[model samples]
Target: MDLAFGADDSKKRKGPSKNWTEREIEEELKKLDAKIEDAKTNSGDVEVRDAILDKAMFLKQEARDYPEAEKVFREAYVKSGGASKKMELLFEILLMNIEKFDIDSVKKDVTLCKQLVDEGADWDKKNKLKIFEGVYCMLIRDLKRAAELFMSSIATFTCVELMEYKDFVFYTVVTAMVTQDRKTIRKEVVHSPDILAVIRDIPFLRQYMESFYNCEYKQFFEAFVEIIDAIKRDKYLQTHANYFIKEMRLVAYRQYLESFKSVTIENMARAFGVQPDFIDKELSNFIYIGKINCKIDKVSGVIESNRPNKKAELFTNTIKSGDALLNRIQKLARALDI
Candidate 1:
């Protein structure tokens, strides 16, 4: 009765400890696993399902378990009833695989693209798919196919709401032009007014037109008369002309600089249907403003020139590098923020 309890006896008297052992922790985790499975099977809330799927994907990605991540995405797609967000995620995964340049992966992406296109993906989305196709074609230097796809994407934009689609269209046109396919150029002109405007604005095109007309004056004049008559009869031409003039100046310096190296004032003057003196004056002004470097040929009263800086070249390149006419129209559209 008078004796104090030993430490072991005192511990026994305290009974079981409050802290959980590893076994108990495992048991709790198993219970949580069951609960999560039940929730997944029965959850009607889209947001909750999405959240769970996202968590799973993130965890798998963190674990560097791509197969598991893909499984999660597929489950999410089914669970969410093919939500656009889930579809986008799936597409992004496919895109990443494509970036690896695995031929198998690219073919898979191409198939997916076709499926998506068939599944009523919006025009804007289809345009993106076409861009990927174009990229693939470009990598192989199959420029003709690339240009065709780019043009197709541009056509798709006629139905889409995004301004970026138009930008892509312009870019596609430029890409085609850079490859220097005159047939493609002519086809684009026939199909796209925006392209026509760009062609009309291009210094090289103008020079070509002038030289051609000067060489075949009667036929050129006849065609010119017909065009003028058509424009006079149609109010649309006036609108187009006004719009073209406004945007033409945006690339004028660059266009002039690029063409000046190979084009004479006489060439451009004939192209514009203006006096050679007028062309000379304009050329002098361009030189003064550092838009171009004018090299005068004393005997011929002719000048040769080139862009004095990269900035000017870039502008010209942007305009003329792809589908010239389409790109110009697109640029004009962008400038108007339309």
Candidate 2:
């Protein structure tokens, strides 16, 4: 944990203490604080001051006093002239309390992260900062941006680098599902075979994707339920769980509608494991908004697609074929001219 200060005087004096009580840690921090002040006044050695502050920061974190730890880290970071590790840790401390961060603080950290990356910080640190930005976006309820940032971070990483970030990928997939932006998701997530493989490694993710792809509305809902705890744990998802659930249901309902010329509300309700009333309301919501391109026949209890009639469909297909044939002949004529 004390990566910055590898050697400490206490450790050399009495090997390393395996178990230090809270009182002992507090005492150590008090002594280190005094030494840090003395080093500032007497030796004026920034390195010595930074080392003392690092030990104090470590002890503060161990004592679960994160605000105090952040103060110590900020001081050390200033003395060290913005060392990469210290800068990364500073951002990390902010990320740990993302919900408490204000919009200005979040924006400041984002700018710092970009500056660090431009100055050639390590890949691990870069990805960590990128993930922090994504988490910040999630905390702010900007899910579309969060999904894109998470994708960019993971896309540049090797498989070895991705193991530590499986949870982030889970967040990205859930964001994609919630936003239902298939164009972006397909380009960013599904098209990347390696990333897809990494994603499928999670058992629940695999189930969700399989069921969603196969349009198994019931199975997809079950898969979502299985990961409900995870959704609750995430700050953004927990806040918008109802919205996500509602949107995903519409997606499932639309897919179900694609398979039928007409289906009863009761039957659709059975497939989605919802009450017929709920299905009726959801269908009305989508249909009114032109999302489902369908109508419900209340007397017949049937929901139907407003697709073209057979003759109209045939005429549309013929026009499309003719256009394609004309384009091909133009290409052939150009080749002949060449």
Candidate 3:
């Protein structure tokens, strides 16, 4: 008759048990736990502790146990005294737990960031904190808090030469809020004076000033100055009347042609880059001389030309006059400068 243990007993005697159940695995884990504790107590064996913590963090995350993962990460972070790698790990873990973490928890992270700041972490790390604060405040629509954080970060780098260019970007953000309604024309807008001061001091800012002023005042200042110069040179002196008229007509024609499908006296004057009254006078003279076959549309305030031959004579006369007029203006400019 066979013995009760039989083949299983023989197998167990020959080697380790092959049919180990969950209970046996648990018992083995308990023995490994004691060994881990012994290693932790050994003053020089930090590698084992780090390895164990790494394994724990990995397992917690892989098992989708965020709370446990975060707990292990925090312990690692604290043990490392907020090392850069540790901070990065903390950031990743916290971001994953954002839905479960409340504002208070985020604020705790912020506090940890402050601690890192106090511990003399790198400026880039501090900037990262500021950026996080800014983004969080923006998400909550807390514009004031966001602005404060941005200003603080700006201040931190203000003394550094490399960061000086950021002043313009910072000022732009602040001034946008200061000058909200340009249409109503508030003389007290903070941005206006600052911009004017910048324009006065910075040579390269001339074009920028022109664009800024055009947007704010709805007037092209440089173009207006050119128009004034044209008027002073064109009228009151018949020396270059023909040249001036031609110059004005060509400009007006090009302007009207380019801007609109149709032309008008006022629009033509605008295109000529001169006062409307001046354009009207010149056109009337052309009509009187039978140089241009044109009709004035009273309804649209436009001058329509029907004869292309008239344009040729008018163009020739205008060119002759414009040359003489430009020469005189140049002489006058030189005399004034002298």
Candidate 4:
């Protein structure tokens, strides 16, 4: 497992297996098989355990036989003695599962990684684990945590094996825009030196962040429209594209409407670079579904903010989430009891 990811141009990151010819692959596997068979007697040796794990990586990266590879990986973990060695092998297994997008396995493996990390892994290892956890979160569409992890790891990012640095920033901005409030976005993201360094290279992404925070509604709408296709085509985000877009729109609309008690429909439409009729229909639909807290004066073509009490809303949300968590725990306990 080559984890030397100290490169600015992570584009050259490629698995060694990709370069091996079919004949070479077959020859290498045969050699590894002999070594593995022989190493079984000397399995207590650290070097023998490493060779066993190497064979596991070969199966994972080349043969793509996940079950067998995972079996070998777990066997290697059980035989391995050193904490560092265990963590290294764990990362190998985690990355292999991640490539396959095996969400359930990822969740299980990440929990183990957390245990290993907490016991002895250094700060660098912990930061790298954040990248792994962040990627797992993305696969599961838990973008809020994913955003937080990515943002925190930006300055010390070394997960180019999972995704390039630029792509990491892209995910950070995309998730943060919908999940973070204006103040946090301004402080953590807009002012982030790591984000600012690479944001210009990505198309429409900078505008997407700046316009929203700066209250440039028309630019924000245009930037969002420009980037919508990319979001829809994304591997991790595409599944949640509709949800993400709707949340973003609600955020933008709420931000704008929160500034005023009442605003004319025509002004709102003009602000967003859309027709009044379009705005009317969109707002009506959002309001009807309780996505936005605002009332429309159809006769006067005005939209009035019906913002709820912030403290009450926070308390209600906390209670609801707590109840949901308790329900899940109870169900899991019942399942275990069986």
Judging by TM-score against the true structure, name the best candidate.
4
Give the Å error, residue 159, model 2: 13
The model with the greater lDDT, 1 or 3, is 1
Error of 1 at 67 (Å): 6.3
Better of 2 and 4 by TM-score: 4
What is the per-residue lDDT of model 4 for residues 55-146, given as tens digits with 9 covering 90 to 100?
89887777666788888999899988756667777787787777667888889988987888778877767888898898888778788999
TM-score list, all predictions = 0.37, 0.69, 0.33, 0.84
For every model shown, the clashing-pair count is: 7, 0, 8, 0
Against the reference, the lDDT scores of all candidates come to 0.50, 0.67, 0.47, 0.82
Rank order (by lDDT, best first): 4, 2, 1, 3
Residue pairs with backbone overlap in model 3: 242-321, 243-321, 243-322, 244-321, 244-322, 246-318, 252-272, 264-302
Q: Is candidate 2 or candidate 3 better by TM-score?
A: 2
Can you write out model 2's per-residue Cα lDDT over 1-338, one digit (the tens) per residue?
A: 21111112233222233567878887977877777777767786665656666664564445656667666666666665444656555564564355454656777767776787787777777767767777677767787777777778766643222124566667777776666455666677666675676766665776676577667777887787766656655545676666667777777777778789889999988887778999899889888887788889999999888865889889999999999999999999999999
Sort the candidates on TM-score, descending order. 4, 2, 1, 3
Q: Which residue segments of model 4 deviate by more than 4 Å?
A: 1-13, 16-27, 40-44, 309-338
Query: Which segments of candidate 3 are over 4 A away from where they belong?
Result: 1-45, 59-61, 82-89, 99-101, 147-338
Off by over 4 Å in 1: 1-42, 45-49, 56-71, 78-87, 155-175, 178-181, 187-338
| Residue pair clashes in candidate 2 | none
